[model samples]
Target: MRNLLNFIIRYGRWFVFAFYITISCLLLVSNNSYQQSIFLTSANLVSNSVYTGASEVTGYFHLKAINESLQASNAILENEVLNLRHQIDEYKTILADSIELPPVAKRFDYVQATVINNSVRHPRNYFSINRGAKDGVKVGMGVVDQNGIVGIVNVTGDRTSRVISILNETQHFSVRLKDTNFIGSLSWRGGDPSIAYMEQVPRHARYQAGDTIVTSGYSTTFPADIPVGVVMNRIHGSDDNFFILKVRLNSDFRALSTVRVIKDEYKSELDSLQSFDFSPTK
Candidate 1:
């Protein structure tokens, strides 16, 4: 205590001088309008910059939640679109043949999922999604992005599923030219990830470059008119009677991150019908 008192006594003059100096600076700024204005401006600028920085940091952390929310909202909208299309199809059927054919029922449902892994360079490219059996994803379900068809789910686990990408050589899609009923088969032919080919299209099928190709609805896997690509070029096929359409695929496989799995609600029913016993007992 005695030592502390002695130290304070020796430095007391310095402390007093420092206190007076701070007070003098405050008085000078308060008395001078220019200095006071500059001081307030600098303080507000620093405060705003700090606030903006903190806001950006907070927003960055909220991105994942925002994305998931968007995905969920998108899924609802897509389902609504499907229902509307189904209604349109039913109306068309009623208009076309009221006495014979019945209205077509809704056959597909969509499950939105995020792509965890994707590869486009390989000849048999595959994609991995974050949804699986637990989320109702199944083998043979068609997968598509917002732009177009992406792949088909080939394997499923409890929480993950692997898809056979449309870029794969083994993958084939039943596609047709937009505005016409002429159907063809679309497949990848090794090389460009952005390009695919539509085969078995008759030479007379009236089509042009920039014409859109879409799902034919011939298969039970995908719905009709889901966009696949745009026709870029047409060439003589191996048979010469058919034209091969060089298509620029709409789905960007390199940038793929999210997709929807198409669940054909009637697929099992169709499969069962195909397997129905018709042989007469001997």
Candidate 2:
């Protein structure tokens, strides 16, 4: 107690000065209109800057959640568009045949997933998503991003799945030229990540440099008409009978973040019918 008293006594004058200076500033600002206005303006400026900085920090943390929500909404819209197309086709069939067919069932389901891991530089490049068998993802299910097709799910775990990326050389998609409806096999040529080639398309397919390529929907793996890419100039390295047209992919594989796993509603039935053994038997 005696030592504390000595320390306070030593600094007492400084403390007294600080207290009077603060009081004088307050009184002077309160009595003078100009000073009061300046003080309020300075305080408001500091508070606004603080609030803005805090808001920016909070918003930055919310991007992932916002992105996931947006992806879910997009999935719903895509499904609705597909159903509308089916209705149009059904109407056309009824008009032509004068026979009422049963309502066309929904053909595809989407499971939104985050791309947990990815790579594009490797030859057999693959990515893993945060969904798997537990989330209704399965082997051979098609995966697509907001832009377009990304890959095919090749392996599935309980809570995660691995996808063979479209950038892989060994991976090929059954895609058709949008205008001519000519189907061809598309695969990455191993050099450029953004470019692939639609191989074995007939030379007389009537495609231009900017024709769109899309899924053929010929198999249960993917639904029809999902945009794959746009045709670049045709390359001269293939056989004379077929044109190998370069395609610039729509989905940016290098920046993959969110994707959807596609489920064919009647995949099991189709697979069973296609797999039945029809060889000669005794």
Candidate 3:
């Protein structure tokens, strides 16, 4: 107690001066309207800056979760859109059937799936999706994004499927020139994922750079007219009477996340027809 009294006595004058100085400053600012306004504005600005900085730090930590949530929401919305489109197509088919018109070819049925893993720089590129037989995904089903075709499903289990990307050298797809409808086979040279080569197009076929290429719907997997890529370059083959065209793919395999697995209702029928050959020589 005696020590406390001695310390207080020693600093008493300084403490009084500090307290009075604080009071004087407050009183001066309060009495001057402009000074009070300036003080408050400065205080508010500092507080806001501190708060904003803290908020940004917090948001940075939450970005991954936010992105995951956004991806899930996008998947849900895409499924709904696919359902609506299928319904509309069904209605059109019904109307045409009632009128005795020829049956229109079924294009594709969109089934939303998340990419579990993807690769771009590889000779035999493949991607795994978080959907399989349980999710109605099957082998040979076509996969695509809003931009264009990705690949064909090659392996399927109960809960997941692996897709052989169009970038794979072994992968081939039937595609056609958008303007001329001259169909050709699309294949990757195993060097670049961004580019593929279209072959079997006659040399006489007319093409210009930037002409769009799309799926030809000759196969049971992909539908007709789905955008594949744009023509980047064309060169006449030395031995064959066809043009070897380089195409820039629409889908970025490296960045693939969400995709739609197309299920055709008439796939079995189409497969049966494709297997049949009525050649008289045979």
Candidate 4:
């Protein structure tokens, strides 16, 4: 305290001068209309700038909450769309009066999850979602984002699950040309996140660049006609009999955030049936 007092005494004259100068400037500005106008304008501009900067900072922090809300909303809308489509099909059948049937039961149940971790540069890329067995997620369940197919669940824990991303070289699924029934095998050979390869396509199959690809419903994991990608190009395979298609995937794996885990209700039953050994022991 004694040192602070001594310091103040040393600088007291300068401090008094500064205080008088500040007061004099304020009085001059207040007395002069033009000066007052300029001062108010400058003050307003500074205040606006400060307010805008503060608002942007607040908004940046709130984005995560906003995104999660949107994801939940999208899940609800997607469920509604699925139900409506099924209802429309039911109505069409009823109008035809070909066969009286109840509304088709839903085949896929969606579990909305956030992508907590992802990889696109690896030979065997995987994704981790914030959902697990407790959330009805299980191994072999198909995972998809808003745009298209994403991956398949390979492992599940109590509150987290790992997915084998479709970008992985080892991942393979049956996809068909959207305009026809031509089915092919979808896989990835790495190096690109937005592109994948489709093979085993018969040369005779009618397809062209920009043709859309979708799930073939051959497996119990994903439902029929889920959007996968569009054909970018085609080349003759080593066999020369099949066409290797370059597909531009609809889902942007690099920007993946929210996804849905597709739960096939009859998957267990289908697996059990397929597990039966039909060959006789030699």
The C-alpha lDDT values of all candidates are 0.79, 0.79, 0.78, 0.80
Give candidate 4 regions above 4 Å deviation.
1-100, 278-282
Question: RMSD in angstroms, all models?
Answer: 22.3, 20.9, 23.6, 20.4
Clashes of each: 0, 0, 0, 0
lDDT of 4 by residue, 1-282 (tens): 999999999999999999999998987556422222322331233433453455444435535655775687589789999999999889887887656568987778999987766679878787777677789987789998877789988766666676788988877999999969899999999898888999999988998799899999999989998889999998779987788999999887776766899989888888999998899999
lDDT by residue for model 1 over 1-282, one digit each (tens)? Answer: 999999999999999999999998987556422222322321233433453455444435434654764577589789999999999789888897645558788768899987666678878787677676889987788998877889987767666677788998977899999989899999999899999999999978998899999999887788988989999988788897898999999876776756899999899988899899999999
Ranking by TM-score: 4, 2, 1, 3
| Regions of candidate 1 where Cα sits further than 4 Å from its true position | 1-106, 280-282
lDDT of 2 by residue, 1-282 (tens): 989899889999998999999998987556422222322321233433453455445435546755775687589899999999999889888887666669989889999987766678877677767676878987889998877899998767666666788988778899999956799999997867899999989878887888899999998888999989999898875489987889999887776766899999999999999999899998
Residue 135 in model 3: shift from native, Å?
Answer: 1.4
User: lDDT for model 3, on a 0 to 1 scale?
Assistant: 0.78
Which clashing pairs does model 1 show? none
Q: Who wins the TM-score comparison?
A: 4
Clashing pairs in 3: none
TM-score of each model, in listed order: 0.64, 0.65, 0.62, 0.66
Model 2 ranges off by over 4 Å: 1-102, 279-282
